[model samples]
Target: MIKHIVMWNVKGDTPEDKADGALRLKTAFEGLMGKIPGLLRMEVGVDISRVDYACDVVLYSEFDSHESLAAYAQHAEHLRVREELGHLRIARHQVDYPVTSLPVCAAAEAA
Candidate 1:
């Protein structure tokens, strides 16, 4: 499986504006979950830190393979969401990695 993670910096001069923009983006990303193929799971997060360099929002998703992730990137529904979010975001960062499951150890062994 492939895990895709993305973080976005919202564009706004005021704190309220940035907060609202983040919520809007979070909602938009969450809405794309079931509509796209190969999208096994989707999650969105709003940053709560007071740090100056913190990102406004984040998206975490999983797919079956690289091909599935590529298709999702070009999917019309996703494109539409991206287009809508383009104006509200100032910067974006993304990373994709393959998920490798490790064997589960016995309870006593884990302890």
Candidate 2:
């Protein structure tokens, strides 16, 4: 499986505006669930840390493979969502990596 993670710093002048932007982002991304192929799982989170350097929103998703993740980037639904929320983000960060099996010790502990 492939993991795709993204963090965003939303744009807003006030606390209320920021919250609204975060909510909008959360709703928009979550709306994509089941709408795209190879999207095994999707999650969106709004930061509550209230830390000065924290990102306003984060997206955690799983894809079946790297191809799936690549396809998602150009998917029409994704493009539409991006266009709709493009202006709401001030900064964006992302990480994409393959999911590996748990270490032997960690797997044994789960049992």
Best by TM-score: 2
What are the runs in model 1 whose C-alpha is more than 4 Å off?
Answer: 103-111
Task: Summarize candidate 1's per-residue lDDT along 1-111 as a digit string, tens digits.
Answer: 999999999988899999999999999999998999999999999999958898889899999999999999999999999998899989999999997764366555776
Q: Considering summed lDDT, which 10 consecutive residues are worst modelled in model 2? A: 97-106
lDDT of 2 by residue, 31-97 (tens): 9999989999999999999999999999999999999999999999999999999999999999999
Evaluated at residue 101, the lDDT of candidate 1 is 68
TM-score of each: 0.90, 0.94
Worst 10 residues of 1 by lDDT: 102-111
Model 2 off-target regions past 4 Å?
A: 103-106
